[model samples]
Target: MAKDKIVLAYSGGLDTSIILKWLKETYDAEIIAFTADIGQKEELDGLEEKALKTGASKVYIDDLRDEFAKDFIFPMFQAATMYEGQYLLGTSIARPLIAKRMVEIARAEGAKYIAHGATGKGNDQVRFELGVAALAPEIEVIAPWRSEQFRSDFPGRAEMIAFAEKHGIPVTASAAKPYSTDRNLLHISFESGMLEDPWFDPSAEENEEMYVLSVSPERAPDQAEYVELTFEQGNCVAINGEAMSPLQVMEKLNELGGKHGIGRVDMVENRFVGMKSRGVYETPGGTILFTAHRKMESLTMDREVMHLRDSLISKYSELVYNGFWFAPERLALQALVTESQKNVSGVVRLKLYKGNVIGAGVKSPVSLYNPDIATMEADPSQAYDQGDATGFIRLNALRLKVSAGVNQSK
Candidate 1:
């Protein structure tokens, strides 16, 4: 008789390694481990060998960096999506892509169940489960952290460590690292552990070593550097005269932005799980691209179209943050975003100085700003009629004037 097969989203981390073994023991099933390389750097090293040694019948490490940058990061930036007006949604955005690939592997391997290491108290479990439901409704999810049997078996880290030791599964995780981090092409996020304290200062000198992608603002170079970006249809196409693919663009910008200590944010944001979580993030490339894109839009995007699109940004951001990337409502919002960017082709220059992305200049062929009509000097063309302002102001103020008169008469 053949055993049931379960595909697990494995990172070779302590939690995932333990879960890999636990799933096999609990279900008497064959375990296939899958890892997605979306630019997590050196974390991918020796992952396959480690997974196989830890009892995975098969292992897969897929590279999705290009797809992640172009399909996910660039599209989100086109709308300038930000959660709660500050966070770049770095960690929130990566979950769906990871879950998407896991489902594909599950189907190919004839696995009916997909398991993940996301804890029930956090948002990632919601993200992973929702993504699987949306993409493959028939597949079942096996989340051990949320399972009563698994929770009862391993009550804490001590029990988990003992289980791994008894099984000879090597683990490097320990209490030494105070916070947890998630890294991708777009950004690196640090949260939990010491960061859970709302009043704790991540910028303190003691915690300075925690930042991975950027230097401290105080230690950045005094000289300001200028960078030029070209955009077409709301996507960054080039940087400093070098035309590059989305992945290449992100890599180059990350280097530049990191040198100047740009794109560091620390804040307490409301999570979809109804709790406030504090996180520190370094999104150097994303911040630079976001600033440049907005400047370019100002030059070429129409007034009313920009206004209408801006109104939906908050809702659009919420959808992405809450694991609705595959939902119908988000697709409708993205359609409006795409139409608004038809004319948003332009060049923007910015000055990067010690974490500041300052606008230097912007120009576009389809620019709506007519100097002749907007200039303070005498217009020989007589482009804008000065006399038109009288009726424009009177017509707009008529209702206000009537309301005042009614109040006075009363």
Candidate 2:
């Protein structure tokens, strides 16, 4: 009889590396490690060899960078979605895409079970599971971190390190650096370890190695550089007048923004599991995209329409953060968001300085900014009558005046 196969979303990290060995030993199942290459440059180095050495039957690394930026990142960018008004949805948006690909690989490999290294405490577990539920409901999810047997066998990181040492699984963990990090093309996230202390300032000495995309702002370029972004129906299509693909546009922005130290966010956000966690992120490309998009919207979008869409951005962001990418409510909200961008076509020029995205200028074919009506230099003949303001003011103030009169009488 053939043993059942389990497809693990392997990052070749400490947790997943240990989990691969444990799954093989404990379940007596074939382990196929699947790694998503979503722009983590060196992180993918020797991952396949590492996974196989760590007891994986086979290893598959899929480059989902272009698809990730074009399909997933751009759509969310169109909505200008930000979780908790700060998080750029870096890790949140990537989870569903990874989960979708994991299910695809599982089906192809004839695997009945899929596993992930997402911890029980984080929002990622919910995101990964919910994505699998939506995409491939038939495939059973085997989350070892949330399992009693696995947790009992390897209680913590220390125990896992010991197991790795005993089993000859080469790991990079040591006493000096203990923080956990997640990195992709869009951003690099750092949390846990020394960051567990809410009051702890991320010291330069301790956290200097965490930066993947950019150097410190103090070391950034002294002179500001201007970049023009062209958008059509809310999708960024060109950079500095050169037509480029979505992926290329982001790549260009990442280069420009990183040099200027434009996108670094350190915040303690409320997780989906109701715990506050500190995450330091570097989202260079995404920062430029958001700033440029907003500038374009200011020139082209109607005031009421912009306000209405802004009201729903929090809900849209929350849905994505909470792993409801495939949910009906999210789809419905996306429809509104997409429709709101129908005329959001324009060019926005921005000045990038050390950690600053300053809006230089914006222009659009759909611009509602009429200089004739807005400029003080407009002809008096074209203006409205000043005498009509008397009745307009009086009528508008009547309720307030009446309330004041009643209050005074009382």
Best by lDDT: 1
The 10 consecutive residues of candidate 2 with the worst lDDT sum are 378-387
Give me the displacement of residue 328 in model 2, in angstroms: 0.8
lDDT of 2 by residue, 1-410 (tens): 89999999998888999889888988999999999999888889899999988889899999899999988999898888999878899899999999999899999999999999988999999999999999999999988888899889888888888887888877777556677778887788888777788777763655666677876677788888999999999999999899998878878888888898878888999999998889888889999999899989988888998999999899989999999998999888889889999999989999998889998999998898877667667445576555788999999999999999999999
- Residue 247 C-alpha lDDT in model 2: 79
Give RMSD to native, each candidate.
Answer: 1.6, 1.9
lDDT for 42 in candidate 1 is 94
TM-score of each model, paired residue for residue? 0.96, 0.95
Where does candidate 1 have its weakest 10-residue lDDT segment?
Answer: 171-180
How many clashes (backbone N, Cα, C below 3 Å) per candidate?
0, 0
Between which residue pairs do clashes occur in model 1?
Answer: none
Q: What's the true lDDT of residue 351 in model 1?
A: 99
lDDT of 2 at 125: 94
Global fold similarity of model 2 (TM-score): 0.95
